[model samples]
Structures are given as structure tokens and as C-alpha cells.
Target: DAGITQSPRHKVTETGTPVTLRCHQTENHRYMYWYRQDPGHGLRLIHYSYGVKDTDKGEVSDGYSVSRSKTEDFLLTLESATSSQTSVYFCAITWDRGTGELFFGEGSRLTVL
Candidate 1:
């Protein structure tokens, strides 16, 4: 977890509320990714944005959306929070995929009742 910071380190919410997690990186890595860590899934990609205003959905994209208006900022929003979505989320940034070095932010832990 270097050069990246995620806000709201911990959160507790109801079943239908909206949730947004912010990731800020100082390294200016063009490739930014959002991932969630679960009990058995390890780390799964939720969404990733490679450049400003350009994004792509990942395997577990349902009920999730992302926006990247600036190089240093990435936002992940859950349209409607659900209990199944409760997990620790991480934001990763890498200078290049070839580098094979990705830096992640301190995870954001979310719990939905």
C-alpha cells in the first residue's frame, strides 16, 4: 500500500443505502484498479480505469460503477449496497502492466446489514 490512499477506512451501512469509496494516488499511475477481497475469492477485480474518463467493467461489476475524472483520483460507487457486497476493497495502481509491480492502498472495510 504505497503511494495510494483510500478514504473511509471502515464503514457500516444498511442493506439499501448507497456507498462510495474514494482512492487517491500520488504516483500518477495511468492504470488504476478497484478490487475486493473475500474469504475464498482472494482478490477479484470490480472495475478498472486506465485513463481519465476511460473505464472498463470487471468480472464482478454488477451493482458497481466507477469514474475517473482526473489522473490522481478514482471513485467506486455502489448504486445500492447489499450484504453480499460486504468486503474489504482495495485500490491498486501501476505504472505499467509490464512492470509487474502494482501498489495498493490500505483497504476499505465495508459492512452491510
Candidate 2:
């Protein structure tokens, strides 16, 4: 275990609402990532951070945003909730970006109705 934690393991909200999720780690890894798991898309990256205040958008980052103010904390926010955005989100950490050995936290499931 890399001391990763995700808040609000499960959540339900109405469409058009705003939702935020938090991911915290104690490992001090250099890279942190947010991903959404869907049936057909598998695990799609939403955002990632390589260092404090250094972040970037990923393949499926249209309605999502991420912030990394510290090396151990990464936050993900959904600007406006949508039924299509309902999915299980996962937070992952990796020390070596080239090796791609990611340690994942328990997923956070979000539902929009």
C-alpha cells in the first residue's frame, strides 16, 4: 500500500450539479493520476500531475478539472454533473513514469440521475 486515500467512496447526485473528489497519498510519489472506468472505454485518463502545481489534462478531460497544490494531494472536480459522466473514478500513483508501475487506490463511484 502506498498510503493512497480517496474521499466519498460513493456518491449520487442530480444532473447539472457540481461534484468534487479528493485523492491523498503519503508516498510522496512524483506522479499522480485520475482515471474513470467505463464499460467500453476501459480506464480513461482524466488528468494527471507530475509535481506540485504541475498538472495536465488527459484524453477524457472535457468536463473535468484537476488541481495539484501539493505532492500528496490531487483534486478532481466535475464542473457540471451529467448522466454520461457517471463512472467509477480511480486515483493512482507512480514513482517511475517510465516503468508505468501504478499503485491504485480503491475507486470512487459516482452516479448522476
Which number leads on lDDT?
2
Tell me how candidate 2 scores on lDDT: 0.93
- Residues 1-113, candidate 2: write the lDDT tens digits: 88999999999999999999999998788899999999988999999998999999999999999998888899999989999999999999986555888889999999999
- Residue 98 in model 2: shift from native, Å? 6.5
Specify the highest-TM-score model's number: 2
Which regions of candidate 2 deviate over 4 angstroms? none
Cα RMSDs, all models: 1.3, 1.2
Q: Give the per-residue lDDT of model 1 (tens digit) for 17-112.
A: 999999998877889999999998999999999899999999899999999999999999998999999999999987765575767899999999
Write down the lDDT of every candidate, Cα atoms only: 0.92, 0.93
Per-model tally of clashing residue pairs: 0, 0
Q: In model 1, which regions exceed 4 Å deviation?
A: none
lDDT of 1 at 31: 94
